[model samples]
Target chain A: MNRVCIVGVGSPSGDDQAGWLTVDALLDLGIRSGDGVVIEKLDRPGSALIPLLRSTAWLIVVDAMQGEGEAGQIQRFDETGWPHYGHGLSSHGLGVIDALMLAGELGSLPPRLDLYGIEIAGTTPGSSPGRAIRAAATRLAAMISDQLASGFSIPPGTQPGYG
Target chain B: MTESLRSVSIHVPVLARVEGEGALDLRIDNGEIAELRLRIFEPPRFFEKFLEGHLYSEIPDMVARICGICPVAYQATAAQALEKLFGVELDPWARDMRRVFYCGEWIQSHSLHIHLLAAPDFFGCSNAIELARIAPEEVRRGLRIQALGNELMDLFGARSVHPVGVRIGGFHAAPALSRIKEMRDKLRAALPEAEALVRWAARIPVPQDDQGFVSVAMRHPDGYAIEQGRIGVSDGARIEAEAFDDHFAEHHEPFSTALFCTYHKRPYLVGPLARLNLNHAQLPEAIKALLAETGLELPSRNLFHSLAARAVEILLALHEALRLLENYRPPDSPWVPVTPRAGVAIGCTEAPRGLLWHRYEMDDDGRVVSARIVPPTSQNQGRIEEDLRLSLLNFGLDQPDDALRLHCEKVIRNYDPCISCATHFLRMRVART
Candidate 1:
């Protein structure tokens, strides 16, 4: 069985919790570890993500992002499109893009890598995820669950874009 | 020089590889520096003010939030201060484990700075990604060592970033023997890699720009101080943490939110280089031998040697952690009970960056009435400015704006300045006349 790993990268700040909330939504949907799927949530893992990326064969990363789109917009990106969206979004020193770049340089990127980004409304400290973000997280969680159920392979010609 | 080129201004909107936001402004007049300001514009995060009214038990976690890169320093310093005021003496087990935990921080923080932040500057690369392209094995080894350090931190603190395992008396819980054994095996394996890193760092061909500055760090008679020691200055003065204010002062700079600190009104150096300068003799004999092999002298005068210093310290931290964890026994309790009394508390520790000092005034109920935490980066601000002035002069003022700006950044980043922790990156505006 091909091992599949789902990592939700986020902090607890407001809409930044989208990633973790999505993970929570996954658990709520009965998509869990065992059965060749590994679930993990990371709080601003930064470069620490490299080791995890190296350990898995198939990887799906869910994160909150700010982009030129409406709040709670869910977008899917593979390796090519992920890099373009990864820079300058993190207030932390090394963001997800930087980590992916490092992993790429080190040849640690998984054989199959997918990124799911939920457009965040805000990242106010000590605040909970807003209504739109929570809804988006749920939607993304179901989408990821369907992907996991289908043996972790994207269908051919499935264009990358907002869901 | 052309009349128009005599006065030039260079501005860097944001600095890369630094921990937080800041900028630099330089004005050169008639082939001389007329003005240079290491402007730190990161919003003043009133962490000290935020500590007011918080319970003493909350300090370790709260302070840890100050810097994601070196949260252990903040947590450990704050814990030490509160423990001192409360008359809490940690169990020997807790004490040893605390040192081990701190070792984790040193290893990880130093590794990150060396591999990701500082190394690229020396290699003519823009970032760690570029550095990896040139030195994939070194970068991989660095990441491995960094991961091992984070694992060590996680052993005690429960997580590497803003760890919550620390408390006033000791850690909230002791790590299991199984985990200790696992981490010990990893640390032992990384020893050779760390040594190789020292050799690689020594061969980096750092520029020969040595300047005069006072060196200050904590000195432990038992070992190279990490968690405890008396303040040691290069001028041969020893002081306790309580006397820190009397000997050193923090003054406001109009250009930066971070305070510029001075030892007796003169800028001084801190962090790895300072630690190695004052306490190299305390290092393990093997580490000393490795330093000798690298042909790096103790009390090194060149600031660029800081990279070497950090590498040496990483080796030291790895060895220290291994030695301590070799005979690990889970204590009945990782921490002892504490009673709070109203009084002023003070503690100091060697943070990965430099010496971190913490002070708190506690009420009878064990709540903080006031708090003052001094991080290493802010303390280095004056020295950074001083270094910038001397280094640029030595490099010659006839250089172009971009060259001058990059040189200024190189100098600042050499300190491993955590602008966020210091209330900091760096924008560079160089004005020349």
Candidate 2:
């Protein structure tokens, strides 16, 4: 069986490491290096995702987001719609919504994708990721591990991916 | 009976006018462009894969090999990240030196972009070599601007390509006051040449505006932030660099080796467009006046207008480089100490292309546990394809193969992709019986 992939996204100096804050928990989920359960972390989600998603069956992305409509909040979404984009991370680069949408038109996209986004305040390491993002990372990792243990049920009508 | 050859296959050992080496797999299936892959096989120097065990001190010099154009930006971000990790602070003088180096790269890279890489499209030519026969004087001014760019960088950073002066806390040796004064002569001489390039850029026939451009630049209230800056966007979204990861996200797709980044789930541009749109107010009076005289405005959406903006940025960098040289001073201590904290340090700097970020992990011994250096090309990859597809549609190709190919190259040049740095690619063989 192919491995499931979980990527923690955060800048270590950024206060909202709630993205990778939960990375330790993901690592502790019995994911061996190069195992069926691949745990990784990233600074930003640039083209690095190509190889990660190609090898994994399911991809669980964890990152710090802006307001969850309120602080100390976490948001989860299956990346079945337009690709999920968030602001206020270390990315002062381009936005690729229409670009990815166009990519989809060209028949290029990962089959199974899920995202766990947490809200954070300052991204500077001097400050701490408020209780909200940290708690969200930990909780999101645990829930995804539960889903993985349960064989990761595919919610209805989603396309199959290379796991 | 009559038969058709249908289409021909073409390949490039090294892709010119764009960065990196890749071959074109233009498979025209029955006269409709079946498969068009911009393949990048520039064997991954395995910068990340190999950088694992190296000391943090070795990163800036080593990773600068990733590209020739934006080496200073790479060194600056790595230096800044290392400094942040060891809790080293740079004085204003150090920052000025860094910006001076940046001015050099911006001038070199942007001039290369506008002249050698992107210019052939505006005129009707195969390359600058061809354009030279027609417009020798215009090309000479561009070469002078590019020459001065490296001259200033070599003066400060020691060399334009993979500078040696850039280290952990600060420079290896601060510039003497007299050396900076000498640069005044070169920059002053280059100023007229710079303005000539500006006028030449203004004369190009590219459209005045593009519809949607999300330029990412550093926004400082005092003036344009060349090397140091907080994150600012064209859409009025300004956040501190600390908030960078929170506000941005990357996802993977099969069609592209480069990961696509989105700011709040929309397509925004970085690089020259982002810098111009976000920091136009900080432009020098001369550059601002140049724009007025040329009849160009900021917050322009036209990707074609990027050439003009890049030229404008070179002008701004020239003015700023001169000012920085005037105020140049050697520090009592060239560098501060940086001790490993066994933690991580995040650094975000404005590469000439756009915002480049790096997250460095170190053990107690300060060996790089892992490294994540985001090049502007990867972030702009999705946008490049977007713009490419748009250009293809815009031109509505009815022309011959040569004309269409030139148009496509022009489209690719718009993003100024450093194809080498972005994750390179592969070729697939389809067996049809």
Candidate 3:
């Protein structure tokens, strides 16, 4: 019943910083940030995402992932349909899947959920993520901003404006 | 003894509900358990080996990666060791805030284990999903407490998982007073729920069996041990962290990927049960009174009481956090300057699981020359197997394989075994004829 939009950011350094970078881009675009929106930057949130997901009406998760697609590819995951593009479990104790599963089981998942994953080349401590991945993060942020500006619902089988 | 079944082998190729991966093998032949191995097969991440040549200031962050669940313990332990070597003293505010951060970990970790991992077995449920169908209210309460813990953690440490706030001498930065005040209010609001959780845990149908095992934990003169304390055992032995190496030794066993630790050549219990058993008298009066009011026995020998002990600790942590928050003051500087000195120093603190011991040898330029870390789960490995042997022997060996497996899982979960933390997911394979 709430009209809140939740954005979860990450704390990975190299390529995994895509999520954090996206949030930065969104802020730069001035996505209305009043009582209606809540943005959270987390360092390996793990299962802690449960409560946040439960309390909000709309959820958007930005994270760096590795999959079959070329690096810098952006994919969107819905509530019932999770992406299976080779993004395995998180290096943290519980990954995003663990949180989503727990939320579904507890009947606490928000009504509308959108997970934006940017395909990354590397996430090592010292290595830099590919330039394409950073561009994808900015593009992903614009897509989210446009969607939020309008009504934030996607028709069945239709893709968002941006990949 | 039932003569109908003379042999039993139980293999759970993969253990569910534990933090990491491992395996459990139980073999019973001729009415005797031939083998009971808590196999830890998770590949080591080689944290210690990689720590070499890293700047001394980076030790906290590097070691924090040891286990996501108990990162604070690793960070705090490493900081303490380096601080000792450099003769740096932390400001009082920073020291107390560390305890607050640790309390958050205890609350969240214990609540997660009790609700999501361990409790399902007590109700004949496979997981929290099934428990939700029956005990929805309890599950919700647990989630609320867990959320509060996360909130506290985020406020103080900047994030729940692998917090980066902690540094070598203290923290990277001190939080504003307003944030602390907000957290205090939330904690105070959740106080009743925490107490209710303790009461609820007290009522759980725990399997009964005495473990005549030695309990080891940290004891502090000021109050309940959280961040600072000396190691104390139930057998009246006390030692400082530096003396830990002299008394305790880790042995490599072919069966386990993790080393089995022993104190004075004997297995000892750590974690919540040990802390409660050894430091029952050290609890604040309010907590002690709450325990008396709840009517749970003190110094419990039954390993199953670990659940109740965890609940009590949660309540205590909430209370302690609130009290500490009442006197919130931001220090002029969060960290004290450290000058690199060449020395080997040891530090030990109680993780939510048990005692986390760290030793470090730093070079003159403040680079780590060598580092050794003994996490709580590794220390409890031998004791876990021993407890399993004794408990299984008493649970009546004639139970169905699944029943026995569940019982074994319960015993293992009682330790809240972070197989990942211990050098660990468990693939359980049991073979019986």
Provide the TM-score for each candidate, comma-separated.
Answer: 0.95, 0.66, 0.87
Question: What DockQ does each listed candidate score?
Answer: 0.38, 0.01, 0.22
Query: What is the DockQ score of candidate 2, to 2 decimals?
Result: 0.01
**Candidate 1 TM-score to native:** 0.95
lDDT of 3 by residue, B1-433 (tens): 5663589888766654345567888888888888889988777768889999989888887787777777888888888888888898889888888888888888988887888777877888876667767887888788888778767777767877778898878899988988888888899888889888888898888888887999999999898887888999999999999999789999998867788999999999999989999888977787788889878787888999998899999999998888888989899999998898988978999999999999888888988888888988889999999999999988978787777887887888789887732211245454656
Clashes of each: 25, 29, 19
Q: Write the per-residue lDDT of candidate 2 for residues B345-405, one digit (tens) a residue.
A: 7888888888888888888988989987777876786676566555654664334555556
Interface RMSD computed for candidate 3 is what?
7.7
TM-score for chain B of all predictions: 0.96, 0.88, 0.96
Two-way DockQ contest, 1 vs 3, winner: 1
lDDT of 2 by residue, A45-139 (tens): 43224335554556677766665466557777764653354432322221223222322332334456676767777767556667666666677
Name the runs in model 3 displaced over 4 angstroms.
Answer: A1-35, A40-44, A62-98, A104-107, A115-143, A153-163, B1-5, B16-19, B420-432
Candidate 1 residue-wise lDDT at A82: 76
Give the top-scoring candidate (DockQ).
1
Q: Model 1 over residues A76-120: C-alpha lDDT tens digits? A: 988888746432456656778778877887777767888888898
